[model samples]
Target chain A: MLLTLGIIGILYVGILVLLALRARTDVKSSNSYLLGGSNLGAVIGFFTFAATLFSTFTLLGMPDFFRVHGIGAWIFLMISDAVMVFGLIWIGYELRKKARKTNYLGMSGFLELNYKSRFAGIVAFIGVFIFLLPYIAIQIRGVAIFLHATFPEALPMWAWAAAIVAVMIIYSEIGGLKAIMYSDVLQGILLLVAIWIVGYNCLHHFGGVTAMFEEVEKVNSALLSVPGPKGLFDFQFLLGSMIAIVLLPYTQPQVSTRIVILKDIKSLHKMAIGIGFFAILVILPTAFMGMYGAVLYPDASTSEFLNMTFISDQSNLIGAIVMIGLIAAAISTSDSQLFALGGELRSILKGDDEKMVFLARIGIAVFAISSLIFALLTSDELVLLARTSFAGTSLLAPMIFTGIFYKNAPNLTVIPMVTLVALIIFVASLLNFIPNHFLGIRMDLTLLAIMTLFALVCIYTDRSKRGGAIEN
Target chain B: MTNERIWTLCKIAVVILIILTFTPLVTPSGIHKPAFMGLPYTLWVGILEAFLLVGITWLATIVHSGRHEE
Candidate 1:
């Protein structure tokens, strides 16, 4: 097992280094380095988007989500993902149309350009920086904890995390988005293969799907239904999850950047469709593995169940591959996110292009180090923490969408101001300074609803005020 | 119908599907019967729902008004 892991690990790192070197040769300017020349094909776009969206969260966090939360995890994630893909084709087009009108570098700068206010861009940057740090942390922590569990006598969890972060920072700094995308292709394939192999084995354990669910039923019938025993999948939670997820491409800079860089609308459309299928294909097996856990290791800790199911229960070769896949998943997602935040920083900066890009590279390293520190301190509830990140970033949606759609967004500085206030209140709720629920509705849902209404009202009033002036 | 109208219909269809997903029709609480092909209730239905969404997305791509835009 050790030898196989070492060989595969070396091969994976070798490919990543080669890809970085190749991408470095293509980096003629800041634009090429940052945005991959803004001409990505459909197949690569789909794989990169998939690899970024479905990360260690899917491979490590999701099966546990299903095991703990029951079948509703499907409704929570996969269904939301399906809707998100559809949204990518629909609203994503509008975003590209708007972004192409400017020298698009990142979402923050785009928002600044649209709102005609530097504060708007700053607000956008702060929201993502505050939320995405924990998200990137979990990706590191998820794989780090799993690796620690696998090799208990090896390095500590923080050391594992630092190693992962160091590898990610070096490769992404050497190459750029292109290198990350190239590695994403490899990571995406490994994730799919490793997951399906384990999923198939788990399903085979009970002879078939029928016997599998039957065994799960005998252990806990609740695991086969909505809300499970924990009642965690109520309507509000599911609804909030869907809204947050569908808005991700708009709200999350990492995903929104992918939309802008697609070669054409046709490629974007194809990529959206492909991602929907990929979501189902990737998430379905997690359900099988989850049910397998529900029947066997129903009460194991997240790391325990994952280690036992993904490694201990499998053959040495398969276990080695799965371990490498986990690392790949973590790196693929984390690198894109850290890089995207840097792009956001660049978008808001004003200077020579070369200097700005150089500064953004430094910003990427800073963000990576911050995320590594957070990874060492964050809790192991990967799925919930990820959902919090999603919800936190979704608060930026109304501000972002208004900037994208409203022709007079520059005059509507009020939206970004209110968005900042909403972000503060949401963070307070997360810190338990206030209740997470307001009047029985989740704070995230309540704030998003209010912000959407506020944005619409602002748009209407601005239109009305303009009409009255024209009449006078 | 025109591609624009078909696109509108696609959006409406997705909205309706999303609404139904929250209701008992797709995720009935504590009810895991009516198994299909040996799969549980919500799981099978959820899987089917996901497929339907992807199918709609695929269809939407063909009829999308911006498909010809660069």
Candidate 2:
């Protein structure tokens, strides 16, 4: 079973490599390859966005969250996905318009010109790197776990990780954005099919979502509430998670590029709606799969629920389909982030397009390597690691909110505000100093709310400045 | 800003507020608890996914309308 899965991984990677090289022929025209001539119609845009949002984490992780936290994780998870759609609907359209008019080639390029400060550009660059690393690492790690589970004897986890990395990077380097989007189009289809199939069978196996919950509630009453079993949730965490939701969509570089790359407003909005629906559908089932696992393996830990009963309980062929979904998820997650990482690194230094692209490829490896180390080294609970990984990037929310909405946000204030706010959340979450439960809520809940408030104030302040300057 | 942007702001505000409302309700419930309309809220989190659907519809209308100036 493991060997078959390993072979599938190699085959998928090989296909991606070929496609990427085809796209690579145009890499010299970075803009065209990266943005696909800025002519991506609704179909392509939707698939790419779907691939970007419906990550492997959702496929493999959210069900686990449901197992541990009960349906409460749904509140946090749903809200986050919904808000990302809301954000894209507005900002994405504006970004598309702005990019077209400004000839803004990338986010950093836009910031440098808009703020008249390279520091702003540099902050955008550095901010993505710091925040996105864990996000990417988790994507890679999830794939590694999936591979390890399926084919433990076929290869070392590290070797599996290397194989996954090589495949993604092949097309990532080859066709740039176009290649990735193209692959995402295929992977997106695979993901959708597998998610529905697995979700359905799990629900059927367990006798349905309602009966499944009856058993789960017996396992733990708290599973129905915000704090669940781990005792890690609270007001702070709740609020933090909310912000993470709004903030989550923008963190991945590929998402940000969609704003600039999308050809027109009509198509972009269509893309957003399509992606939103697809994402909501794909993710909600994983939660049900958790509910399904509830009846089958009522005593399992969240991770065990996700990886074991829900995923592996099925026949080997079925398991391979699940693995394929995960690989697509991992590749989609990694490729988009790596592409964005490439752009972010390029933004750090101004001259020489070829050099910037080269350095960007190198940056992808650096991030992958670091994440590999962190994956092997950290004994942290996998679920908590995901949330903590989330906290690390909570810093970028404030900065981005300010950038998009605040026209006169002081150049000096952007980085400090984002850095400070995110860091505080990270520290508070780590120390467990914040209330793990807030007003009957989990900590992820609290953390999300705090970040939202911070973003609003800074962005509002920036907006007020624009009005004031215009009036003056 | 137009009513559209105003609506966008309102939508963002409403979403955030909804999240706040959920703050008090963050206590664990069974994984299969049904939400409004008989949908398991966990599976249907996307229904109320922060007006992403509404927001997208709005944007699509704007884009297709060709009301946008370059």
Candidate 3:
């Protein structure tokens, strides 16, 4: 197993280096370095978007989600993803049209320009930064903790985290977004192959799909139904999750950037359809692995269950491949997020292109280090933590939609201000400074509804004021 | 109908599908019988729903007014 892991790990690193060097250029303009030349085609766009959106969360967190939460995990992620892809074709088209008219560098800068308020950009930046850092941290933490558990004698958990962050920073800094996208193609394929192999093996353990459910039924019937044994997937939770996931392409800068950089609407539409398929293909296997865990390691801890199912039960070569795939998943998502953060910073800065790009590069490094530290400190609830990140970023949706859809967005600066307050309140709820629910509704859903309504009212009032002025 | 009308209909269809997903028809609590091919009720239904959505999205892309735009 050690030899196999060594061979695969070295090969993975070798390919990453080659890709990074290939992507390197003498010119380091923001457009090339940060936005990957802003002309992505369908195939590459699909892989990069898939790899970024489904990461260690899918590979690591999801099986555990199914194991504990039941088959509802499928609806929670796949249904939400299905809706999100549709949204990509619908609202995403409008966003691309609006963004292309500006010198779009990031969502923050776009909002700043459209809203005619620097505060709007600051709010956007701060909202993403606060939410995204934890998200990036969880990706690193997920893979790092798993590796440490798999090879307890090899490296400390924080050391594993630091090494992953180091690799991410090195490749992304050297090659930029192009390198990351190229590596995403590799990661995406490896992720698919590794997951299917393990999923098949897990399914084969029970002989067939029907037999598998029977075994799961014998262990716990709740694993076959909604809300599971823990009652985690109730209507409110699933609805909030769906809303957050659908808004992700617009509200999450990493994803939103992908939407804008596609070479054309044709590519965007193709990519959206491709991702919809990819979502099902990727998530379906985790359900197999989850059911496997439910029957075999139902009482085991997360790491214990993952280790038993993914490594201990698998062949040496398969385990090594899965390990590399997990690392690839972690790196693929984290680098894009850190790079997007830097891009967000660059979008807001008003200076020479070279200097702004330089500053943003530094910003990327700082963000990566911050994530590294947080990875060591953060808890290991991968799916739930990721859901929080999605929900947190979704708070920015009303403000962002107003920026994209409303021509009178400049007069609607109140939306960004309100978005900022909602963000603070949401964070407070997460920190337990406030209750997680208000009047039996989740804080995130409550805040999103309020902010969206406020935005609509603000737009209507602004339009009416203009109407009165025109009449006078 | 014009492509624009088709696109609008696709959007409305997706909204209805999403709304129905939360109801007992798709994700009824504590019901796992009526299994198809040994798959549980919600899991198989949810999978079908997801495929339906992607299928709708595919159709929408074909009729999308902006599909011809560069």
- List the candidate 1 regions with Cα displacement exceeding 4 Å: A26-28, A468-472
Q: Is the docking of candidate 1 incorrect, acceptable, medium or high quality?
A: high
Q: Can you write out model 2's per-residue Cα lDDT over A326-348, one digit (the tens) per residue?
A: 88888887788777777666655
Stretches of model 3 off by over 4 angstroms after superposition: A468-472
lDDT sort, best first: 3, 1, 2
Model 3, residue A10: displacement in angstroms?
A: 1.3
- Of models 2 and 3, which has the larger TM-score? 3
State, as a TM-score between 0 and 1, how close model 1 is to the true structure: 0.98
Q: Give the number of the best model, judged by DockQ.
A: 3
| Candidate 1 docking DockQ | 0.90
Return the lDDT, model 1, position A206: 92
Listed per model in order, the count of residue pairs whose N, CA or C atoms clash below 3 Å is: 0, 44, 0
Model 3 chain A scores worst on lDDT over the 10 consecutive residues at: A463-472
DockQ of each: 0.90, 0.29, 0.91
